[model samples]
Each structure stands twice: as C-alpha cells, then as structure tokens.
Target: MYADDTVLTVADKEIEIVGRNTHLLFEQTKQYCTANDLVLNENKTIQIIFSTRDHTTTQNITLPGLENKSETKYLGITIDSKLTWKPHIDTLCKKLSSSTYVVRRMMQKGGLDTAKIAYFAL
Candidate 1:
C-alpha cells in the first residue's frame, strides 16, 4: 500500500523559524516513510506560504527542497497565500458554468423536466 496526498503545514512569526521547522519536519517525515517502506515523491510535493506580503515576496519563500506554489488545491478547495476566497470562488464558478452548460444541453435535447432533473442532481 502507498500513502499519498499528505499535507504538512508549519507556521511561525518569523519566516526563518518556519523554514527551519518545516525542514526538520520534512526530514522526520522522510525517515518515517523509509521505515514504513514507503517512497516519498518530491516532484508532487509543494509548499505554500501564508502571508500578507505581496505575492512576489512570498514567491521565493520555500520549504528547503520543495517547490513553492502561489495557490494549491487541498481537500478540493483552492487556497492561496493571502487566504482569500477568490481562488476557490473562481474554481467554483468554472464548475458551475460547466454544470449550467450540461443543464442547458439537457433542456435542448430532452426538455424542461430533464433540465430540472439535471440541475437538481448537480
């Protein structure tokens, strides 16, 4: 069995402390994976910093060996460093738009009843 899609978060008042703690935790996680006969895929791993600074300032703040991402999806929710709802709202809008299209198609092909069913199902 493989363990996957794990998320780790570290926070501190100081960026340096956060980085150091994250590094230590990452190392410990690697060791645990090794003992459990699991392989950690670094390529799929990413780090995101939550801060009020400009995006550019946070862009370079990384957790040692991991890539930094401006925004990422966790548990199907989009989160950004600013922790605003924009990203998640945008994603939700896109999904709703697609569902609207499907419902519209059902109305054209089937009827109002079919469209209502599809919309309610969604």
Candidate 2:
C-alpha cells in the first residue's frame, strides 16, 4: 500500500506530514484521518514526515480515490435526483403561485400587514 502525504488540521492548526512507507510507522492514523475529515487523494499522494512545532509525525495508509461515491444524509430530506427535475420544478411553482394568490387576496382586503408579511416571507 502506498502512503500519501498527511495533512493534520485541528482547530486553526495545520500540520503537513511527508515521508515514504509511513503506514508501518503510524498504525491508527487511518482512523484519525476519518475522524478529522481528512481526505486523501490516491492519484497524487506521497508519504513524508511533517515536522511541527511539537514533534515530527508520520501517516501511512493508502488513501482512497477522491471520487469515491458515498451516501448523503440530510435532516430527514432524502434527495436523489437522477436527472428528473420537471416534477420538482412544477411543485415549487405551484406552491409559489398559491402563496401569491393568498397574498393578493390579503392585499385586496386592505390587510396590508398580512400581505406585506406574506410577500416578504416568500
């Protein structure tokens, strides 16, 4: 397995690791990479020891491809768009028109307060 350059970022600190065959040196570094949201690009990766203000560190692991696909999770919103946008666009437009009609009615009734609120909310 090829070990790539590791970039450790914590808070506002950034440490770059450079060396060769680093995986044998740091065993648990892969888990650390995942926990820290560090992405390794396999295509253009290298291994090295990065000397920081504290000490020198090494990371050895074959970084996966950057283009690897993974599941996306959101707050109760599952969006899987497989080139289908017509239905979504239509629904959005319908809701918008309905809201516009409600505001128009409020404006006709001289309820400027409600109309203004609805208009701005949209």
Candidate 3:
C-alpha cells in the first residue's frame, strides 16, 4: 500500500506564522502515518512559501524533514512562490514543441493526413 500526491496547504499573511503552523501540521501528519503503519517519504516532501513580494528580510523556512523549494508541481501544474504562470507556461510550451516535432516526423514518414491526425491526438 502507498500514499501518493498528498499535499498540505497552509496560508497566512505573515510568513513566520505560516512556517510554524506548517511544522505543526507536518508533525501531526508524521504521527498519523506512524499510527497507521505507513511510512511518510520525507525525501519527496517539499515546502514552498507563496508570497507576492520577495521575502529577502525573512529567514528561510526551516523544517527538519522537508527541503524548501522555490517551486513545486501539483496536479500537473508548476506553481512558483510568486504564483506567476511563467513556469507552467514554460512547461506547456516544451510539451507542445515535442508534440510538434512528432507531428513533423509523421508528416515526413506518411503525409499531411497522418500529421493532422497526430496533431489532433496530441
């Protein structure tokens, strides 16, 4: 048995309070997993602080088991701390380029009809 794609979201105006609450929630999750005989994959866990402004003055959020990340993927969308869509758009562009390459290859091998089908399938 395994747990996949578990996410915990804690929001606050102040970063420090959010960090403290996040740590509490993390500890609780760990305890719950232990009681249920499940192992939490700490290595796969990450902490991302979402803020409109850059948090230069504030210290980095430090948790024992999870590494802090500037961005993370959730539900196939790349989310950055600033909540900008740049990362997600970049990822989408790369995927579209790959699909375009496949369609071009199909056109070379078969014809325009095959390429059209491939493009629609993608």
Ordering by lDDT: 3, 1, 2
- Cα lDDT of candidate 2 equals 0.47
Q: Write the per-residue lDDT of candidate 1 for residues 31-103, one digit (tens) a residue.
A: 9999999888988888877888754534234656688887999888999979999999999999999999999
Write model 3 residue lDDT over 37-108, tens digit each, in one string. 888888888888777887874453568767889898998999998999999999999999999899999999
Candidate 2 C-alpha error for residue 24, in Å: 31
C-alpha lDDT score of every prediction, in listed order: 0.83, 0.47, 0.84
Residue-wise C-alpha lDDT for candidate 2, range 1-122, written one tens digit per residue: 33344533222233333223333333356666567776545455332222224332422222333321222222322222232345456666888899989899989886899799879987
Model 2 CA lDDT for position 28: 59
Q: What is the C-alpha RMSD of each candidate to the true structure, in Å?
A: 2.5, 15.2, 2.1
Q: How would the candidate models be sorted by TM-score, starting from the highest?
A: 3, 1, 2
| Reference-based TM-score of each model | 0.82, 0.32, 0.84
